[model samples]
Target: MKSLSILITTVTFYLISSMYSYAQQTTDQIKDQQFTEAKETIIQDEREALKVEVEEINNRLQNGSISKTEADTLKNKAAEKHAKNIENRLIILKNTLELADRNGDQEKESKTGIYVGWDEDANDFVIKTSVKRKKEKKEVYDFRTKTGVYLTWGLLDLVDDDNSYGNTDVSVGRSTSFEVGISQTTRVFKKSNFLRIKYGLGFEWNKLTPRDNTYLVDNNGINTMEQFPSELRKSEVRFTNIVIPVYFELGPSKKIESQNYIRFSTQKQFKIGFGGYGGLNIETMQKLKYREDGRKVKQKIKRDYNTTDFVYGVGAYVGYGSFSLFAKYELSPLFENQPIDKNLLSLGFRLDFD
Candidate 1:
């Protein structure tokens, strides 16, 4: 009986020793797995740091603050270091995880599973990530309206025959005029440079001089005859007229580049239009010099002596940038009872606006 008890005690001690050794082995395996996981985390953090450094270098290059040589050197170093670190970390992680798996330790396997769960959670975090910001769009305008004023100088040409006034030997001289005007423009058709409308008001001055000794014969049924010299007839004749003009203009569409309170430059560079004009003579004054006035004395004539007539013309405009120029010819006689209808021609420059 004493021998059996001693044997039983020895057996119990050996079993306890074996159980403690197994427990210690499990703890060590768990510790090693945790250490490996920590090393992997440090490797991943170093890679992210390298990526940040590379991005910083690229940003510096874009900002023109870094030299090309320095940027290239830094980029190469970062790439090489990142590659080497990744290769080394991958080898270490593979070998360590393989050894932990071969060991068949439950604690190490559990730790590795937990780390995989953490990795899955990180992947989910990345998948759920988003950026929040307000998006904006650019604004644009289609059509624009503009206004302007201009000064013009031109010649007045009359197409009507002066001989109808019964002065066969009379000659009509060129009638020159000065004009000042204001204009307005509106965009009409937009695409294909199709159309626009321009309207304007202007004042005109005309001067006319007769070139012959015309005669007017008066005969009575009682055989009485009378002859009047051209100078005498003209002495009673007046020659100046003022006009007010209004016109409707149309042309190709254009874009405006620069503008002031009163002027603008446009992209629509060419224009063609036709309009009518009429004016009231606020003041028409004329002076007559005759042979009887061989002493060169001048006589003042009234506005009513010569008839005030309407003036009109057709014209075209062409230009680019801030400057625009136009040329037009008058379509009607500037004076009434004249031997010839002298037409007017004009050239003008205008400043445009919107």
Candidate 2:
């Protein structure tokens, strides 16, 4: 188990790093273009202002409030003023660009608490306000809850009881589990976001395929496996549960602090969570496929197989970004009355889109 966990950790981190590196380097090559576009905008705006100033000077000359010489002087002064304004503003803009991070994360929280960052995905400027100012007072908002949807799927099998000598009756390779749900993460500390309470509601599906052409048989009240009479193409038992999995997630996040708001982001970072899940077994079903009298036949069996109704398990995960290596083990017995007790065990992957 330790070796397997280490392998999963290494592989998951490697994959996440590769993906993030590729994405971070894939720029639109639009930063330089933004400079040109901004320069053009400045020139156009100054020219328009210059034109208006010149018209006003002409109007003054027509009214005889100023002579041609005076009007020309005024127009020249206005033109020169606008030219200097353009030069100065352009310099400021250039300096701002220089201050930006070279890696294209040019998002800034300006000194004046105002920001206009380029949104590459939106192809527009994303303007943000820091705090609301009223007279001499400012109101700042700090929110602590973040929510996201998670999807998980992985290997599933049953762990034989320590007291029992029976072997596993299901094929580990053929068994699988899947879960999908919404999660809400809240900072556990007032000043630090390193520790968080992550909880969610998920719908889980666990399927186990019996080994050696065996099918689940309810011998009176006890659920047992029996060899299929015909050539068994497939034999599987599936359980669906509505579970609530809660985990205490610990991770470091980069702080995106502004004058008005502060946020901690764990995107593309390392995190580990240890928690458990408890829920009710909503449904149980079995599927069978075989050939009978030269005809293919399929059967869907739904009956009480003495399966546990309430299910609970402990789980842990460690990963970077959205992907994680997830492992879980159930404490409750799978069947109520059985010769050998079997506990459900699973090792899989989880993706939390938080």
Candidate 3:
């Protein structure tokens, strides 16, 4: 009876030891698998975050908001993150190889997944997995009118030696003029938006101040400059016009593409344009501000003054950036049926804004 009890106790002890060892081994296997899965998940999440960051940096570069050097720095950081991602993947492979060696699992060694290795040229790790990406579709925009506003202030003068407005009495310095305009630009070519036709409406004011105390006078449908009576401080002839201008503008342009639209980029360098304009005179006036009878006085007279009711001109511009050199010469005479035939000319610069 004693031998039987002892034998039963030893059997129970051996079974308990075997069961405990099996449970512990199972728990260890579960832990290792969970650890590997958690690591893979972390690596994947990190790689996705790096991809998002890299895209943002690339956007800044294309938008011209960041310098090339800054972009390169960001790109290097992204590469480093990519290298780290590869390293994490390789670590899983290395652990699998070791686990296979300890367990004597030849199949795991033979059929291992995701072969990752070092790439010396790239200074990073390379994955042997191949992934195919879908090609990006391009979105094109319909032709539309692009508009801009410009402000111009420049010198105004009369051209032609015979029509020099009564022998340089019209001081060029005092003939400063101003113009404001709105322009609509249309692309002339579908493939190349660099060539464009621009047409717009503008308001111009030209002031011609005469020297030697001279002022303009109208007599019998004729315009002439006469000496101002009394000690005149200043005298000027002013004309206002509403003009329509057409131009063939040419320049180098870049395409700016968004997700849903594409358009030509704005370029401010090395632009050339030739155009013509026609307009109607809105107002013509002469002003004389002088001291009479030892008192301050002013005279403003509005008149036909034989000035041309309609005017047309050809002009050209060459520019770098917003500042441009511009020249315009009128085809029509300054006055209609005048005693002297004169033509208007102007040279100036314009500041453009979108």
Candidate 4:
């Protein structure tokens, strides 16, 4: 009976010791898990706060609200703070692991060295967090819109004239027109960047050199074409106009792989434009250079030779690259009810410099 009692006591003691050890291990594991969770929460919060601050700084730099030097300084400061936070987290982890080893928690110690839930691999026992900046909302119209001065040269023609002269009666070289203008262009929509609105102010000067030595004479209120007795080298009737023009422009923009700003490029792209212009007759004059009695004589005369006061025209342009073919047909007659009815037409090239 004494031997059996001794045996029973030994078994009971061993079982109680085993139970007590298991209970102690379970409590330690719970404490370790809670500590890990608390540390993770702290690290996550710090990382998120740092990310927000970095993003704000980058956005300001992208929009020209902050200078490069300031941005670099601010970003460096943020990086330092982030690095410090990570260093602190790593230190906490190291202490936790040491404490787990001291407490004989082998499982927690092994897991800490095995894996770290982060954006990158943590085999080196360091945690790195990154701040991803959102793409900026840039004002596209300022770059897309073009403004510049353009030069125009066109062939001037008279249609439905009551004069004795035919279509070929005007000198092609001397019957020339010139235009100088400044234009502003803008994209209509953000998505539809190809469509644009262009408008501007300009001047138009038309010179008509008759084929024959004919001078314009105002008979009462009529402009009569007459011949000069002297041989003439040049006789040109000029009309100067101040006009406002508007057009709908369509083209592929100069594509650039850029993130910040854009500029006008010399890239070739297909483009088309159609528009109209209206203007007032600002001046009218006739210049004549002729030889009279073997001496060169020059004369300029201002006349009310019955030219129309208001003028308007419809025009279209098509081209590849910076050069374009252009044509303009006058909607209003050049001269009112006279012995001959006439309208002006122009054909040439349109060059855009932005």
Top of the candidates by TM-score: 2
- The alpha-carbon lDDT assigned to residue 12 of candidate 2 equals 36
TM-score of 2: 0.61
Candidate 2: worst 10 consecutive residues by lDDT?
21-30
By lDDT, the better pick of 1 and 2 is: 2
Model 3: lowest-lDDT 10 consecutive positions: 104-113
Expressed as tens digits, the lDDT of each residue in 277-354 for candidate 3 is 999998999888899778999889998777788989998898876678888778888789965577777888977775
Candidate 2's displacement at residue 79, Å, is: 38
Evaluate residue 55 in candidate 1 and report its C-alpha lDDT on the 0 to 100 scale: 75
lDDT of 2 by residue, 210-283 (tens): 89999999988878779999889999999999999999999998877777677888888899999999999988
| Residue 321 in candidate 2, Cα distance off native in Å | 1.0
Is 1 or 2 the stronger prediction by TM-score?
Answer: 2
Question: Candidate 3 clashing pairs?
Answer: none
Ranking by lDDT: 2, 3, 4, 1
Best of the candidates, lDDT: 2
> How far in Å is the alpha carbon of 123 misplaced in model 4?
38
Segments in model 3 whose C-alpha atoms lie over 4 Å from true places: 1-138, 163-167
TM-score per prediction, in order, is 0.39, 0.61, 0.59, 0.57
Candidate 1 per-residue lDDT, tens place, 169-243, comes to 333333345566676665564333345566666665655433444322212212111233434434222233344
What is the Å distance of residue 63 in model 1 from its true position?
55
Give the residue spans of candidate 2 off by over 4 A. Answer: 1-141, 162-167
TM-score for candidate 4: 0.57
